[model samples]
Target: METPPQRNANMAQIFHRSTNFISRFSLFAGIFLAGLALTGVLGLARSPYFTRQNVTRSQPVQFSHKHHVGDDGIDCRYCHTSVETSATAGIPQTKTCMSCHSVLFNNVGYLEPIRESYRTDASIEWVKVHRLADYVYFNHSIHVSKGVGCSTCHGRVDQMPLMFQANTLLMQWCLDCHRNTEMALRPLDKVYDMAWRPAANQAEIGRQYKAERNIRNTSELSSCSTCHR
Candidate 1:
């Protein structure tokens, strides 16, 4: 049988080479797939849908911040009266709305809810858009008093027709400001000015304010207990 056509020595080498190639290829493919999965997860986490940024919820009354704050030039503290004095910025009560609407848009259909709530002396359960975990003990009064403008955290509420969560409000988000608070700081008098802009020498001014206020360093601001109580 022609000595069974003796198998070539190269056959073993070829088989080994093929197996090694497959092993390396598989390792690379696994790594690529794992990388893709990780990237996708991170992208989803930061997306608007996940962060609830600009997502408007249905409110009992479609109170437009754009109209009230932007058009009418109403100060933020006008409605959020407790922002500077309390840990939580208290929502405007029914009477608070009627204080203006009852005279301004009293006949408007949208103001009906306000009138009803006022007539009944019932509280309007306004849906909270920005909410942090209970474990996070945030003090609004402290932040407001520290020269941090409302727009720093709430974004341009004057432009938002329906209030939405402007910032991610994540721990990292809070730390970003706490670590470099100078960027967000404004004059105490301008805290309620939603359209407030920094001066040309804002950095220098911010440093001055930081020194004057004796603000804590990044190490303390980023500490676990800073937000987590």
Candidate 2:
């Protein structure tokens, strides 16, 4: 009355015994490769080729911050006039260079560009070393007023034979300072001092300066609009 269902000889196993292991190994290998690819992309993004850190830029005139700030002890404000009062650190006009070079090295062969620019009332095409993305908005005055020194972001310019990007200038780098800003504060008088260092009690001093200056909190400083807008 009951005919037992007979297995068909042609019906073979759809999967091999090793199929499970192969499937699992394939999944793991794909995941590992994906992770490796992501890591490589992230590393490349932060590398000097992308960030331009420590890479010296060629300039129209071979101006040396070392000679100006180190050898001659010239102040930063002499060239960057608007640093204290404006969003931009204003580039020095040809006249500013003429103020010194007119007498100091007026006849020098290399000084001809300065003379030509001044004579023609045209600006010297000085290549900018520190450049932020166009979408980023940075103010020199605000940072200076808060006791953030020039060398804090610019590095030891007095020691550089040619100006280069000392830091990565990445969003993460800015966020690091914004998150722990007190550590970067100094006396207002020392804002331009390239060699200024914190004393043994700098932590205490920085907190005091932070309070006195009423610097914004980390949340505000690190907010998207702070730099982006």
Candidate 3:
């Protein structure tokens, strides 16, 4: 048998650029970004967490978060309009589903549960996964106006096949983000799409809100009494 040629350990490099000048530089850049991605994944895994992968799931209706949030590119406000101004991201009524499916599907496949709900005059039982205790007052608008983006806590809904609660929905996790400004937020609306960081410092924006509200400190952010009885 003929002896096999030894493989060069470094030759496995994916980029075939022959110019050493740019090739080495590209190699380092690729490795750096790769390391960053690995670190992010590790951080998510170690931290107390939830994701569309784990949030209250198994919707009997088989609605697609990805379709609405992804292909249609519908803003959260279109359906859960209250998030911008209310405490809860109110669930879309059966009418909302029928409004679209009336002409879209023209079949009962997607609208069956909705039709049944309408016939019975009952709300479709959507299992909410990210539930905070009654005493914990969570307001959607305050977080949005304070520079918190939706994706930070909810994860990437557009990419999820089924919606899962992406955040741990725990008090500690909220506090942890409150303490760390760097990882806290992103472009205001970007939260609905994915985890995006703000181009500018969010602390400055928060300070403006502070002055507007006249609380003057992070202490005003949230207290037990603020949301609780």
Candidate 4:
């Protein structure tokens, strides 16, 4: 007589072949969604909203760079006094404004804050436009000495009605210039020129200046300590 059916043979299947496909699809979909989410977060971090590039901010006094620098031919150093010799670009004191406003537009209603600041011996709480993280250390004098122009990072301030950040000022943006610095170097005399443009032979000129100025190599400039410290 035939033996009774084995227990294993009689056992029913718990999962179907389609279950394999469903499991695989679920795993891949989760991975894809996770990757997409990560990419979106990174994009948002670098966006204009986060970086504040090209966004004009209101100041305590509405100082117009366009009128001052473009129309009046005022130099940047008149306001940012320590840019050439100090790590920080010193903000223009109330006296600096009084030097001119005391003669020109002295009685203007908008400039009442300036007169008040001078009289009270209190500093104008001017809002800073181009701000960097506290962890990062930037030296204005070092970059100025390296033949980098004011407009290179600050953009065309002479044309700006209100001062705003012209670039992302991100670490990668800095690295791009550091890796190929020859392209950004300008004549030292033209450092403050807002209308300065790259000449047809700018590449050649830049290479020459880079060599003469003894700028550090890409590896050095891109190092962590270069900007962090």
Candidate 5:
């Protein structure tokens, strides 16, 4: 019943109104999400430390880093002793575990499963959480020589009930820590502090104590020559 001209005009007006409403809604939504994302990032950046990553690792024997490293006061170097002295802090051999188990495996609460594994003559399949490709070479001694501590790479291990690879441990991550003289190059005090805060004189103190403890050319921290021929 309406005139054709009037109908066309009405249709054009409706379409124009719809397009404007959609455009404005989209713009407002985009701005709101961007603002929210920026706020989250800024909040993260402002903190003294980043939020703890949401990760957990459970291993065979329920090996407790907290119990060993924190409660018993066993140093990381004791189990991973070779790290500071060798190219790799090689996994503790069965003998290493047996040494402790021989002494403590009888404790009813602690060694039940551990003894079971020993009885079976099967090594506990340790769930290695942190790993890199075979081609990437990392030397514990080199980092230790530079006064980097066990915790720097391992994260707050004393807090972990089970040992997981806490850091991303990517090549970039390695380079970042290795490159920062202000960070990696630190004092003898820095080498031991699992809970180090910070200091201005850290680098100078670290540099002063370049350990004369010669890393014996015994393949430690060396390349393929250490592992292969």
Candidate 6:
């Protein structure tokens, strides 16, 4: 029998060409998707919503941290009273500002909101600068007690006329600090000092504090459960 004049060679060649085209197309598609994904990630990282640098929101009163903390030498705990005792750092009430501005700048135009809030017995709606996700459980009291200074996380508020977020407040950033806590640890007395710097023997001091406080290992501190749970 003639058997259809030997068609196997041509059929095999067509099948091979089709598969090659599909493989090439798939490779190109994968590369395109990877590039797009990388660009998106980079854009998000640099966006104002993520970086949060120099991003200030207008509040009921235009309070300047530089004026209050830097020029006036006000302690952070004075306004954020719960920083040392709670997971959330509480916002200052109108009474807190009136404690000083009541007599100092009571008639000033900028102080009108403060005066109004105080008179109305309503809390001043101070805009939050540093905020974390609800899922992330960060305890300011624990961080403060562990010798992490305010500046270690909050940055130099004393120098900021309008407070803005300094750190990214991302999980990776927290993990980095947790992995290397010594770099941020300070004397417990200097927890509120925003301009504190590491002294000559700061590392040794940090080690001593870590031992005294029985800080967990880096692996424990960087665990997902540490923040997520």
Best by TM-score: 4
Q: Which stretches of candidate 5 lie over 4 Å from their true place?
A: 1-54, 105-110, 203-229
TM-score of each: 0.87, 0.89, 0.65, 0.90, 0.61, 0.83
The collision pairs in model 1 are none
lDDT score, residue 19, model 3? Answer: 69
lDDT of 4: 0.92
Ten-residue region with minimum lDDT total, candidate 5: 213-222
| Model 6 deviation from the true structure expressed as Cα RMSD, one decimal place | 4.0
Please state the error at residue 21 of candidate 4 in Å. Answer: 4.1
Select the stronger candidate by lDDT from 1 and 4.
Answer: 4
Query: Candidate 3: minimum summed lDDT over ten consecutive residues — where?
Result: 213-222
Q: Write the per-residue lDDT of candidate 6 for residues 80-193, one digit (tens) a residue.
A: 999889998888777888898878967889788888887888777777777777898889899988889888887888998887888888777888889988777887888888
lDDT of each: 0.86, 0.92, 0.70, 0.92, 0.65, 0.84
lDDT of 2 at 38: 100
Which consecutive 10 residues in model 2 have the weakest lDDT in total?
A: 3-12
lDDT accuracy of residue 223 in candidate 6: 88
User: Residue-wise lDDT of candidate 4 within 36-76, one digit each (tens)?
Assistant: 99999999999999999999999989999999999999889
The TM-score ranking, best first, is: 4, 2, 1, 6, 3, 5
Q: Candidate 6 — what's its lDDT?
A: 0.84
Per-residue CA lDDT of candidate 1, range 1-229, in tens? 4555656745555466688899999999999999999999998988888889889999998889999899989888888899989999988777778787778867988778788888888777788899888999999998888899988889999999998999998777898888887887888899888889888888889888888888888798889988887
- Give the per-residue lDDT of model 2 (tens digit) for 10-52: 7989999899999999999999999999999999999999998
Ranking by lDDT: 4, 2, 1, 6, 3, 5
Error of 4 at 93 (Å): 0.3
